[model samples]
Target: MALSPCGNQSAVPTTFLLLGLPGLWETRLGLCALFLLLYLLTLVSNLLLLAVVWVDTHLHVPMYLLLCALATSETCLSLAVVPQMLVALASLHGTAILSYQGCKAQMLLSGGWACTNCFLLAAMGYDRAVAVSDPLRYTTRMGHHVCICLVVGCWLGGFIVAGGMCGAIFWMSYCPGQNPLNHFFCDIPPLLAAAQGVTAPSEAAVLLLSLLVLGGSVVAIVASYGSILVAVLKVHGGRSWHRAFATCGAHLTVVVLHFGCASFIYLRPKDRYTLERDCLLSITYAVVTPFLNPLVYSLRNREVHTALHKLLVQRRVEG
Candidate 1:
């Protein structure tokens, strides 16, 4: 906690102002409405996927179990950021102020849950590879216990990573007058950008740590998919190829969207930041990505679709 200059009291760096969507004044309301719709869609779709997976015995396999865990993470991620963003967007000047506790909480949720989603994607990719490459050994290799361990590891690892990064950010002293963060929620770059002074090293460390986590997951996903590709090509069966594509395509789409949107390609020096573009990227990743995740999973998965259809049909029959 840093001391506020106004009074020599133990003042935490509370009340951060988020600049939700700067320079988009004209379209802010429309964007807000659009994101509100997308937010709701993400919630409903992921929750439905979870519920479907939970009750349906057929979706009890490792792949579907991983997917269910993913949906759960996505639901948590969206809830952590979207509602607060909506509130921020409705505010005057597109600035939403958050307490230190709230800011740190959002960072933990978004950061940890995003890490969970990334690792889950990698895990899902690995699970698919095992299925495609060694169908016979898939069940034996990826037993229920192994699957549980993988999911738990992802969730736990994400929290540890996020806790380290957020703790680093929150401990720094935020200078007055640098209150407006370019993104909708409290994130690493923005928080460091607004810190008092001499934070480059800390910021670099956080970025490096984040890259390490993401990079490791990416390596795993690429390796899994690469092996999957080789195995699918070696097998001259069209059905095998189709199955491989169906399993990997959705996961790949999600990977591309999530990483592409969240990547720091446009991240220049702090003074050179283009806030509107940054906010747009944040919004796309935070809002649109979650909405797309379950859509891709559900449409590509026949078993899940079948389960969902049966559930609806049974409800209608009972009615």
Candidate 2:
């Protein structure tokens, strides 16, 4: 059979190499175990947090609703990349080869969930602003329909944006000799670097589009939080202001970690593609953020804590 150049018969490499953290030979086992533990915590904690939000009547508020969405997105985002990474690390495969389709799918899901999270966090900031600025109209303004719309918008926007970026990335020909990805999964930057010769134009376009999406999202988030800070300051009572700050502080911390790491990775110029820095930042968002989200939100939220206690008691009685 004569194989077409554009088809799968283009002699596509079945496996790709993954070059993990630069110099961790001494701590390889320790690092893998730590990441494994973190992944377990991320999965269990996020699922529990989501269940609590769903079942607890006291948590039927805008803040908790947004938290649930955030948790869900984080779960998806982490699942898209982390488990595969763990497997690769466990096997100690110098080069991990993923099928072409699998690589594309992983990239799609990761980018989609990450982008959706960006918008969802912004929506959360907006929700906080309304809750603080118009305490009287908070319920009416952030009603069921409005919340659904915002959540839907975030997801839909993320899907479209990520799809576009991934399409731009994969719409190019590939020759031989470039199969190893520096990172675990098929991230945009690493993939682009791999396709250096045959798809230079497409790679450049993908990089630009990613920058625009990430840069614009960061600007929106900053603006939303700027307004939120202003609104927080105008409250009358010291106690009320302090409570508001406390409520939003955890969210602010997560937002900073997410955007700060992502910006350092994506928004920087192509000339600054340091493998060490890239790996570190990727771990921050892909690993650390997922584990932190549940801890920060669930532990700090009195309602979640109370509901969990009740559920535990109920389980004990049933047992």
Q: Pick the candidate with the highest lDDT.
A: 1
- Candidate 2 residues lying further than 4 Å off, grouped into runs, are 1-15, 92-94, 198-204
lDDT at 206 for candidate 2? Answer: 65
lDDT for each candidate structure: 0.81, 0.78
Tens-digit lDDT string for candidate 2 (119-204) = 88888888877876777998999997899889999999988888987887777544443366778667877776665335656757
RMSD of each: 3.0, 3.9
TM-score of each: 0.91, 0.89
- Over 1-319, each residue of candidate 1 has an lDDT whose tens digit, in order, gives 3444433333545478887656777777887899899999999998899889887888898988998898899889999999888888887776688887788899998999988887888888899889888989999999999999999999999898888888778777764433668778887667876787566666666767677777887899899999998998998878988888887888898889877775662224456556666667777888888999999888887888899998899889999
What residue runs in model 1 are displaced by over 4 Å at the alpha carbon? 1-14, 176-178, 265-272
The number of residue pairs in model 1 that clash at the backbone is 0
Model 1, residue 61: C-alpha shift (Å) = 0.9
In candidate 2 the C-alpha lDDT for residue 159 amounts to 85
